[model samples]
Target: MKALSYLILIPTDPIYVPTEEQAETGADALEALMPAAEEVTYDMFDDVRFIDGGQAFEAITCPLCGKDAQAWWHNAMDKAAEAEFEELECTATCCGGQTSLNALIYQPAAAFTRFTLVATNAGVGGLNETDLTAIGVPLGCKLRVVTQSI
Candidate 1:
């Protein structure tokens, strides 16, 4: 089977949001930190497969309030909930300050092949966690680690 991989880049800090506005102007500082993937094309004869290696943040701080916000690594299949994935708590000395930060790498199972196929299809739009789960990816949910560095 031909294995496919996607490198999704997300901010270690929740303060940043990826959007079209950032994609334009060609000068968004956040663009430097966004994730990138190599180009690949699958032909009709190719077998579809997926390899998990995406990263997610543990904690992000508010630039103004400096309050810490926890991070999560959710499986596409897992339902969204208040306490579904991992959570990082504030540890900074400052009152209400947040310090913990984490990044997670998710690997999809064999079932993820369906999602990959959709993502690769020319008629299909794109694939998000929800789309991945809708197809049949396993639920290996939750943040697995916590650390200062991303």
Candidate 2:
């Protein structure tokens, strides 16, 4: 099934992974940090995932129609693996508008301590050094951030 999520991932798990309780604690910290955001969830690194989600569309919007890109995603799926785009520039099939994959808007697809924290309507921005440090204090380590769309 298709899901719309923005994933925040770790570059590597620590030598000793946190317990679910630890994960929950970390998630709660994040919740406090991003109170406007949706609940945070976790996913342990069971499968290898991209550190940087290259070519992924943060959102699919046609410049012309100003509508969801899914509206014109007629043949895009078939070309996915073949195109292997780190970024794309094309014309929409629906309104024939220009299309370009750009910055992530929302929908988290993360593996947060094996939990989830999605803010579909809230805004997410880069975590500064201070913020990262705060988040790490509870988890006892720094978390590398990667943005991925699903």
Candidate 3:
């Protein structure tokens, strides 16, 4: 079987979601940048969802203490999943600091978002920062890109 790769753009703030029109504009902007992309789409969810990087995912770290937070993150993910990710708050074990799962630093860039703009077969390894900022303009929010292969 062949692997499929996706380039997903999500808001830097997990709780922030663009309006449908804004999302469409963002999608259009991304399409303009990746004209050879096989597909481009945007999705909106009623609740925040974890947008992981699939095989690209690596270790996670606590934003507070800069320690390996894989174990803590997993447990917190389970708890948050119970609520369908409606709540992302958690307490960090390393520093005993309170934080949100969304704030955890994910290797290879995973994120929590209620909306996403995705491009399949993006046709390029990555977008430069300038291109990303251009795409984010119409969406009215800064974006974080997550590349996933599955």
Candidate 4:
């Protein structure tokens, strides 16, 4: 059966690119927030490709200008994928600014570890402020909350 999952992207840094120390702290804080929350690394999403419609990306591309920044992005992701562990990360090479890879889409993008709080019984609408605050504040990072029913 499919279930609605609240995918909360809690990066160690506010910009979404976490340092080694911050990632570790965020992980601990997350577990403290929800003892039942299962921790996962980017590898869990082994073959996820970012495709908005029918297109597939080979690497990071500009979502707004639709430019190919794969070469630059590759270097960034390799360095940032799993900061506390393996470190897969990226900034907007195309945008020429501090845009986190977590905020952009990648084709064949490396999976960065994050949290998923499943509201199996309540579904998406049931998520509340208490739920948001509990997860957000303790982590000391911004929360990218999105729902996935699967």
TM-scores for every predicted model: 0.25, 0.47, 0.91, 0.37
Question: Sorted on TM-score, highest at the top, how do the candidates line up?
Answer: 3, 2, 4, 1
User: Model 4 over residues 1-150: C-alpha lDDT tens digits?
Assistant: 644343344333323444445545555554555555444222112222221212355565665556777767657755654354233344566666555555555553322333322322232333356665555565555454433334
Off by over 4 Å in 1: 24-87, 90-150
The most accurate candidate by lDDT is: 3
Ranking by lDDT: 3, 2, 4, 1
CA lDDT of each candidate?
Answer: 0.27, 0.49, 0.89, 0.45
Q: Between candidates 1 and 4, which one is better according to lDDT?
A: 4
lDDT of 1 by residue, 64-100 (tens): 3455423322322232223322333323333444433
Between which residue pairs do clashes occur in model 3?
A: none
lDDT (C-alpha) at residue 88 in model 2? 40
For candidate 4, the per-residue lDDT at 56 reads: 50
RMSD of candidates 1 onward, in order? 15.3, 10.4, 1.6, 8.4
Candidate 2: segments with Cα more than 4 A from true spot = 1-16, 54-121
lDDT of 3 by residue, 80-138 (tens): 99999888999998789999998889988889999899999876767888998999999
In candidate 1, which residue pairs get closer than 3 Å at backbone N, Cα or C atoms, i.e. clash?
9-35, 52-107, 56-104, 58-102
